[model samples]
Target: MNTYQHDWHTSEGYDGGLHHCRKCKRSHQGPRLEAHDCPVSDAEHHAVAWLGHAGLYRTRFDAVRNFEQSVTPVSVDELFELASKQILSQINEGCQRG
Candidate 1:
């Protein structure tokens, strides 16, 4: 495992903008980043780790906020389907390249 220091970046806004890591995609919902543990490596983990809800911390910070604020109707089933399809596409592409 390769532990990495967080490179925290803040969004441009006045409302105590979010601070998120550019590497592991961990996010904090405030202007200041508090202490937290990031993933040890950049390697991908099991899909179960982030295959369900859109609120997963691994998601981009801005995406989470936008999703929360949007009134559009989105179902978890659809999210899962979209995510799975993308994942399968990536895997197939990688396999073909290899």
Candidate 2:
């Protein structure tokens, strides 16, 4: 199977347009943060597993580190779900403040 490799950093400063959340259909505003490289791929494939909004990491090691620090022994899918909710809550709070 052929795999596509992406350099996520290249798009960091560029306004590639807004991203819409598939589950919530909420418009994710502003310039998106670049996905960190996957440590498993040695920084080749920027594999992004959605968490809350989106967690960007440069490596699998970093992703694991984040999960370890932020969450308990949950599966990736569960972690992502939790993270997504966390992000959405933060955003909602910010909107309320504004």
Top model number, lDDT: 1
Across residues 1-98, which tens digit of lDDT does each residue of candidate 1 receive? 44656668887555787787876777777667554456633333222223224444333344455564422223456568868988999999999999
Q: Once superposed on the true structure, which residue ranges of model 2 sit more than 4 Å away at CA?
A: 1-72
**Model 1 regions more than 4 Å off:** 1-4, 41-98
Give the Å shift of residue 36 in candidate 2: 40
Worst 10 residues of 1 by lDDT: 43-52
Q: Using Cα atoms with residue i matched to residue i, what is each candidate's TM-score against the true structure? A: 0.32, 0.28
In candidate 1, residue 41 scores what lDDT?
36
Candidates' RMSD to native:
13.6, 16.3
- lDDT by residue for model 2 over 20-88, one digit each (tens)? 433223343466534432222322222344222135444446666666344122445555786899899
